[model samples]
Target chain A: MMKILVVDDEPDVRTLFEQRFRREIRSGALAFSFAYSGEEALGYLHEHHSEVVLILSDINMPGMSGLELLRRVRTEPAPPPPPRVMMITAYGDETSRTQALALGADDFLTKPVDFAALKEKLLALPSA
Target chain B: MSALYNFDLLVAGPLCMLIVLALRRFFNLAERLPRWNQALSWVWVPAVLGFGITAAFRYRSTLLDDAYMLWVYAVVVLTLLLLWNYRPARLALLALAPLLLHRLVRFGLDLGNLRLLAPYASLFKGWGNFANLWLIGLVLVARSQKRLLAKEQQQRQQEEQAHQLIATQNAELERLVAERSATLTQQAASLQQALEELQLTQNQLIQAEKMASLGELTAGIAHEIQNPLNFVNNFAEVSAELLEELAEEQAKPSPDTELELELLGDLTQNLQKITQHGQRAASIVRGMLEHSRASTGERSLTDLNALCDEYLRLAYHGLRAKDKAFNATLHTDLAPVLPLVEAVSQDLGRVLLNLLTNAFYAVRQRQQQGGEPGYAPTVQVRTRRVGDEVEVQVQDNGTGIAEAVRQKIFQPFFTTKPTGEGTGLGLSLAHDIIVQGHGGDLTVASQEGRGTTFTVRLPIYSPE
Candidate 1:
């Protein structure tokens, strides 16, 4: 089962994400973890480093935004290199996208989340 | 010592009066002049008249009683009259008093003695007491005219200087105005350039968002269409196998015709399922096409309740297809009797989809945050008639928005969602449609820990 870590400031947004993936979790197709802030997401990563295959993050947040988190994650000399990060934004601009892409984010998604495409992304995820 | 005079009462009195008047005009004009030129002329008038009397005394008439004295008096009075409007006239009049006294005494002492052999003794006697006083008045008039002339010259110079100063100030004011206009023009050009750059940036952002949404949609749309495609693929395989089986059975010989008829009927039923799948694929493609150009569409008398119900299910289904465990229980309190409004049906559906999905996400967020300890996640959608407008309210009892973020929550490119999860255009677009397009309003009221409610109002049948 692939473990996906989702980080955002909004709790309902994260919970709805879990509900979307509940069937996959029940069927043993994917595993899930959630964090409210970038700092918490990092803490989750420190413990569950081996299991996590992908990271989804929100860019605008209090105390260490998603871009900062992405940069920090990239800088660290850790095992299994780094999980493929996909930025999930409710608001997007060229500057944010350029910065995230430069920091090694694998993809970008705008909200009003399209689950079907996300499923394809999950299915297309490298050999985890 | 052979001088003789008889003072004529009329002439002497008039002569004194004229001198008094002359002195008065001189004094008045003295202060008013810049340098007193006209005042000096007053003194000359009296002196010239006195010389005429001296001439008369040397000729046939006496200096005292002759018309020459009267002529002298007349000249003095005329000078005074000429300068009557000047300021120094009072002092000149005071000087004329002593002259008047001398004239009075001479006239009284020598009256009726109209002889040329008038004694010089009387002349000297008559002049002695009043000569100094009368001469002082003469000197004042002279000095006054000099002073008056000088003042006029000084004032003329000052006027010329003032006029020059005013012209210089006008020039400076004009220069300042030109500089300000140029500065404003430069500022306007800079502002225009900035506006153009911003417009280009906005257009690019819109295009990028479209591409992103399209990418997101393709996966879900592919997944949705895949079911039908698979069904078509499977049916063709089954039919091909059936055709092979029938060929072998027919080659053996047709002993039981009823069995063949039953097989034929089953074949016809499979074709219907194939046709159904084809129809479903087309409908999804149509939904996607409708979503492509959201700004351009026709208005219709839309059933708001029905549109909301349908889009709400579609949005939920879209989310559920990706993660089945993302179980958000949706509760609806739709008004049974709702008003139909003139609006773009598809656009209204899009707005409903956006609001419902946001509510779903809000509820899901609460569950993730340990928001309510251990509780079931729920999203509530309610519609009602609020005044003349119909209100569609979507509420979620989730970890609600903070006060700080709530004010700008609906602004374009403002979102709490993860970078890829939202375009932030959803709420802003919804707001524009509800307010500008539909002549209504969209608003939200929320508490941090409790939940949030988004209310949308729609005008009923009122196109204007």
Candidate 2:
């Protein structure tokens, strides 16, 4: 199964992602793990470096931000075959998109996230 | 010659008394010439007595001549004494010198040749009459001189009185001018004080206008955030519906009990999140309503952390609502165990709003300048309890304020923003609200091209 890590400050994001990807999970095509902050997401990545193949992160959060988290995930020492990181923000501004792309974000999305389009993009990605 | 002598003896005593009385009455010499008055007093008494003696002893010519000569000698001696004592009348009294000389001559002739003098007795009598007429002329000259002296004395007194009046009037005029100038000075001071008060009132009015606009911006932000919150609610509801459908499928025969349990659990969690987000939206609406409401200037114990957090969100969203392209990383470090502070929450909220708005503006401006690459526009808000004070700090990693601008930042009507973009009373009003209204302190520290930090220190207890 393809493993994905979802990071957001809101605890409710876990439930939303679980419901949105319920069909794929039941079919044994995907598995999801959740972290509520950039720091927690980094910890998860360290523990399961090879298991997590994709990371979905919200850009705005207290403490460490998503952009910082992305920079660290890309630059910091880790196992070979790093996970693709996608950035999500409430403000869909060109500056944030450019900054995210410059910081090596694989994709950018605005909220209320287009889950259907997000699902199509995920399906199109080469499976692990 | 005898008849002429008799007429002279009868009239001379009375006429002398009459002349002295006229001088005293007409010239007011009794008051003007005191020594003359004293001498005249002695003369009038002797003349009257001499007249009495002459009238009583007219039959005895020898006795009559003795009385007349005694009186003449007394008059001459007193007149000479008056001329010595009273200098002003010396010239007038000198006219009587001839009378004294004539008396002495007659007396010498009587003593030398009484029978030989009988052949020229008429001539002698004529000379004696001329001497009497000269005495009369002397009296007229003395009267005229006395009148002139009296007029001169009156003119001198009048001039002196006029000078005194002028001096008094000048003193009164000077006093009036001094009094008027003092009043005018007092009025000018009061007017200056009034003008200062007017300027203060005008600054307060501009602050109120800024607050009103902030309230409107707050309402707009509430509406903007509300849209996304509504979407969240709708999406959560839809997810719950999908979960029900999954649960319905599991309810059929031979359903996977484990999957059914998980679907129900996710449905319950989704519904709970919907409720949580709805409450958050409700609180934001309430905060906006409170901001727009008229302030009652009431004080209460308020949670500083909550106030700061709410204003931070409002300011960020407000800016975002205006400029959708703006974005900044916000960091908050609120002390976990902070005490409630006694404060006017509405006024304090305005102060926080203003500070946050300024921080956001600074970051946005720096972002637009686009000089430094990899510059993440960042704003940090921190609250701490420092002994008796609660300190709030708003820091921005953006273009720092210049040293010159920082000095006058809190002054009213001092603006750095272009016209129509800022009212320039924001910092001034914030300073006033914190320092004057709540008896707190507001201070700033900045470095050009680096960053800026604004610190607000509020007392825990309200000042009485």
Top-lDDT structure, candidate number: 2
Backbone Cα, N, C clashes tallied per candidate: 69, 0
lDDT of 2 at A21: 80
| C-alpha DockQ for predicted model 1 | 0.03
Q: Which whole-number lDDT from 0 to 100 does residue B399 have in model 1?
A: 78
**Chain B of candidate 2 vs. true chain B, TM:** 0.61
| Residue B86 alpha-carbon offset, candidate 2, angstroms | 23
For candidate 2, what is the DockQ-based docking class? Answer: incorrect
TM-score of each: 0.47, 0.58
- Please list the C-alpha lDDT of all candidates, in the order they appear: 0.68, 0.77
Q: What is the Cα root-mean-square deviation between model 2 and the actual structure? A: 10.9
| Backbone collision tally, model 1 | 69
Q: What stretches of model 1 exceed 4 Å from their correct place?
A: A1-128, B1-147, B185-216, B246-262, B301-342, B370-397, B402-414, B417-424, B439-464
C-alpha positional error of residue B221 in candidate 2 after TM-score superposition, expressed in Å: 2.3
Worst ten in a row by lDDT for model 2 chain A: A89-98
